[model samples]
Target: MAETVFARTPRLVWRAGTPDDVEALYAIVSDFDVVRQTETWPWPADLSFTRSRCIVTASDQGASGVVCQGDEVVGYLGLSPEGKIGYMFGKFYWGRGLATEIGAAAVAYAFDRFDWQCLEACVFADNPASGRVLEKLGFEEGNACQGPCRARGGVYPIRTFRRPRA
Candidate 1:
């Protein structure tokens, strides 16, 4: 299947992922450091688990795409049907400001493509860097909650952030 281009930044291209791209993505996501910051991606993630994410259908309710620099998959971005957005980048990409750049693009794309009252994101309380990114994109801190982390293998405190329609 042809990968659909979702959005692009000066340094990144946001596009639909394919099964062919799974191995590279898996390498990034399976890293303990990377997955620990995410609420959904499993630690020790297998190829099958990664493949399941790459296999997107047109009927899929929300955006699930790879963040690329030229041909390299640097990260993954997901915006669920429930309006929760999340992202994770490979270790090499950390501290690069790519997350905030891609995030701003994702926020614009979400509000433009869908009629949502706001876009929300869940940041693990420990991951203040992600919380900062959400804030950079105009999300304000909301209520706290707890959720299971597939990587952490337990529930973790979460800080919710939301960017309401202007």
Candidate 2:
């Protein structure tokens, strides 16, 4: 199958992820700051795992979109079949409004493509920035719970958020 373009923002292109993105993605997830805010990306980045995740099997089509600025991979945005959305960006790209931009696109695409009534997302409680991104996308704060963080090798406090189809 051919790669599909999923979304576009002022500075990013969200497109189907491929194995070729492994290296760039690994670079982003390798940073402790980046992975600590995430749920499952392990610390000490492993190329093998990145490779496995980047593979665009028929099952993953439209699920994992590589966020790029021009030709460089800058981030990842994915929505699971169950309607859980997750995203991450390179450290170099931090302190910008990219997350909020792509988030709006993700919400639009997921709601339209999956026709789900709601989309779910969560952020480590310490990551107020990510929570703000969700809020900017109109996600409502929901629950507070403990969640496993593979990168941190332990559980962390998390805040859940949900966005209803609009």
Candidate 3:
């Protein structure tokens, strides 16, 4: 049997997402409330397992981990293909500091494993909670701009943040 290694926090575990995690991942991300602050996810997210599989399998470019509390997948955090930092947790897990913990771990992993000098993040102007997460993780706010938020089906103002590897 293969052993499963996990990145951990006081109350959560983080591990590389695999194809086996697709269902659990979909369950978390498919919740409209869970992704309402996101820029890319469609409101009625394409509930395709294949799409989820692609996300899990593409973690080779950067770090990607499923945030868990015991066996339940509560969220995910990772660097995107474009090298930006991103994360999302189940609505139930919000306000518990899980995103901040996961963000810290992912940032450390990215700096250790990749040659990138810095990582960037963008949060919708309306979602200050996410902006706070980035701030807590040492990401400094940068210029604001307008971006298409597929979930909202319109262009919305967004604020960008960046964290340089120390």
Candidate 4:
């Protein structure tokens, strides 16, 4: 594996995923709304389907993190080999600037540890909070695509954003 990006924000520590983390990871990722927001898949219970997804996730992605605020795992973030980073927070932990703060650390860590020149994120148009966080973190909005972006259950505009090289 390549070097993992460990992000340290004021409120959270973002670290890579492990086999041991499946349970907690499952809890966060399986949240109905959160899953729907980030994925193009159906709502899944903790059965073989979800387990396989987790196993393959461990195999394919080099960096996965158990997001921790001290002793509690608040959320998770991932950096793909292609330089795309996906993130989500626990529903209870939202609206506290935690996402942007974690995003800042993740972005910085990606730039520093991976020598990445840029990073990209995809957000459903309905989610303004995500867009604002990306913009506040200096991600420039890109073109939008009309999509049935799996989660929304209908065709809608999908906006892309990117953080350019400094």
The 0-to-1 C-alpha lDDT of every candidate, in the order given, reads: 0.87, 0.86, 0.77, 0.72
Q: Which sections of candidate 2 miss by over 4 Å?
A: 57-62
Tell me how far the alpha carbon of residue 35 in candidate 2 is from the true structure, in angstroms, after superposition.
Answer: 0.8
Write model 3 residue lDDT over 1-166, tens digit each, in one string.
3424436777777776666677887877788887777777677767674255324523457656677888888887767767798778889888988889877877877787778889999998988999999999999999999988777788999999999889
lDDT of 2: 0.86
| Residue 107, model 3, lDDT | 80
Candidate 3 lDDT = 0.77
Name the TM-score of candidate 3.
0.87
Better of 2 and 4 by TM-score: 2
User: Mind giving the per-residue lDDT tens digits that candidate 2 earns over 91-153?
Assistant: 899879999998898888887677688999999999998999999999999979999999889
Tell me, by lDDT, which candidate is best.
1
Ranking by TM-score: 1, 2, 3, 4
Error of 1 at 125 (Å): 0.7
Model 4 lDDT, full chain set = 0.72
Q: Write the per-residue lDDT of candidate 1 for residues 1-166, one digit (tens) a residue.
A: 4569888999998888987789889999878999998877787887787888866532346888788999999999988998888899999999999999999898888888888899889988999999999999999999999988998899999999989987
TM-score for each model: 0.95, 0.93, 0.87, 0.81
Residue 46 CA displacement from its true place in model 2, Å = 0.9
